[model samples]
Target: MGVRVIGPLDAAGLDVALAPFLNAQEPTAAPYVGALVDRGWVAPTDAGTYVLTQEGVETHAKLLERIQIQRAAVTAGLTDDDYRTLLDLLQRVSANVDAFASTLR
Candidate 1:
């Protein structure tokens, strides 16, 4: 991921940015943003938003690359049919969980 990929830098924006890795709630990203600022990975702008520093961009790219590598390794022996079957099973399980959850609501 690059700075361009992240788009925004406010807490709300960060919530979206961190969603994939953290599955964080919208209000919870503030602490994560603060941590990023403290680490010099991001800088607060006069607009009260943040932007990725050069180091942040570099780090994000590295992390994304590493994830890609890991994903490839994990799926190395899986065929396309295997992937489709896995996806279908996961979707069915998710739907079942959602149905169960709705009952508790």
Candidate 2:
């Protein structure tokens, strides 16, 4: 992953924070925000905004690893099958992480 400089962000702030990298308008950003919440990267605050949790920080670190792997695969001219395999591996890993985290709660 190309190390993108990120700072604290909320749902409404994505356009500004991601301007240099992505043209993520609210239409696109909403689903991503929902997914982040769904995956435990973000929590809805009482103020009706979202904040990144400790789990979000940790999950982002893992996502960076996957980004790097995919970048390498693309650079090597790997086939779509290789990408699919990586996606499958990531899904299994996510399921395992979810299960393990559940045990602690």
Candidate 3:
């Protein structure tokens, strides 16, 4: 869970970048754009391209909370049985969601 800087992207591109970690979680992107802009984490470069600013690089580098959280969770009493069950459950739910989404497509 090393930190990676992401652009001041529009909602769609932001989703693509965050999808790996954001699965099953609803992320607030629109408001984040404004917030990030305000904080100077990102900046608009053109009509479509948004670049990760210097602030973003430092911020992400400084933040490893996600990595720490996973480390803490694994340090907890999480056995292999619990791990497998969680993975299986996630897969099953994802499969169902994918099937439903295909219908919409």
Each model's lDDT: 0.77, 0.72, 0.71
Model 1's alpha-carbon lDDT is: 0.77
Candidate 3 residue-wise lDDT, 4-102, digit = tens: 545556678876776654544356455667787789987877677667688876786666666677766775787868777978899899889877986
lDDT of 3: 0.71
Worst 10 residues of 2 by lDDT: 19-28
Clashing pairs in 1: none
The local lDDT score (0 to 100) that residue 20 gets in candidate 2 is 40
Pick by TM-score: 2 or 3, better one: 3
Overlapping backbone residue pairs in candidate 2 total: 0
Candidate 3 lDDT for residue 75? 53
* Alpha carbon deviation, residue 70, candidate 1 (Å): 0.9
Question: Residues 64-84, candidate 2, lDDT per residue (tens digit)?
Answer: 899888888674875779778
**Comparison by lDDT, 2 against 3, better one:** 2
Residue-level lDDT tens digits of model 1 in 1-105: 233465546766776666644531244677777898999998988887889899998998898899978977987899989978988998799778767886886
Candidate 3 regions with alpha-carbon error over 4 angstroms: 1-9, 16-28, 69-105
For model 1, the stretches where C-alpha displacement exceeds 4 angstroms are 1-4, 16-27, 79-105
Alpha carbon lDDT at 79, candidate 2: 74
